[model samples]
Target: MEKYPLKDFMDASEPIIVEDVLAHPRVSEIAHTLIASGLRSFAMVPIAVGERWFGVIALGRNEPSTLTREFIRSHRTLAGQAATALESMRLLENTRRRAEREQLTSEITARIRETLDVETVLKTAVHEIGHRLGLAALDVRLGVDKDLLTAQSETKIVEREKEQ
Candidate 1:
């Protein structure tokens, strides 16, 4: 008896197959393990998006059944909906990241714009960004080829933010 279908459908959200166990070995093997078993048919659709492989939407039945073109078409349609949700999430994440980066850059720029000395800029940026992010460590990567200026932390300690 098979432990399960070749794959388990996660969040497939609907009953989509019908079959019998003793006749269809593939379905029986997987279903036999369950008490209300004897499923013999199977259907699955690959939830693929671009080059990324996500998952599958699957259904099983207890009689002889074939994964037909119609089932595949329906499965892929649901998979496409899942793909759309994924795309929306990805876009939202990207938007949030970009906005955060811009805000950080703006804060850093505003603090340093008036200061001619690189030392003050570095010190001010470290204090502002560190507190904003509640970061444990913040370091500026200095590269000479990129015309990046050196910004070193001052010897004086910056008092930690007050307890909320």
Candidate 2:
């Protein structure tokens, strides 16, 4: 990974400033590729917030000595703001998923309460849960004393009658 400057910079969580890519020993292996891409100098700032690191913000220039200390400092500030925005988006997505799960549970419970038939309740539960979880099939089993109630998508209901 040391052969790649971007990986090394991200691992160190530090800014990498190369004044001349062709003359830099650290990026020597990729110097020709960088020059072919019309980049003589480049800088990378790690996008991070506290201990969490997202990635690196890389910028390149066609001329050498273009990426100076001031340029890198400004980019570091930009990387910080980007990382904060990414973290905020992640938290919002998690909250949305949690709310969806709670809503599904409430809907299933309400449907179950409206029915007195055990078969209907089991079918409704398995169908809703399987669809929500993207499962191709689902099964549910309930036991009481020596009797058992089973439900499957393909097989339907199978219940043992209670002993008379």
Tell me the lDDT of candidate 2. Answer: 0.79
What value of lDDT does candidate 1 attain over all alpha carbons? 0.60
What number of backbone clashes does candidate 1 have, counting pairs of residues 3 or more apart or in separate chains? 11
Question: What does candidate 1's lDDT look like per residue over 1-164, in tens digits?
Answer: 02335544323333334344455444454565632654456565556566554666656665576666776677778888887788788889999999998998897889888797655766788767776777766665344454544433433343323232
- Candidate 2 has which clashing residue pairs, if any? none
* Per-residue lDDT over 13-132 for candidate 2, one digit per residue giving the tens place of the 0 to 100 score: 578888899888988888888999999998888777776767778788898976657777888889988988988998899999999999989988888788889878887787778777
User: How far does residue 18 in candidate 1 sit from its true spot (Å)?
Assistant: 12
Error of 2 at 38 (Å): 2.0
TM-score of each: 0.58, 0.74
Question: Against the unseen true structure, what C-alpha lDDT does each candidate score?
Answer: 0.60, 0.79
Q: What is the lDDT of residue 64 in candidate 2?
A: 91
Residue-level error in angstroms, candidate 2, position 159: 3.7
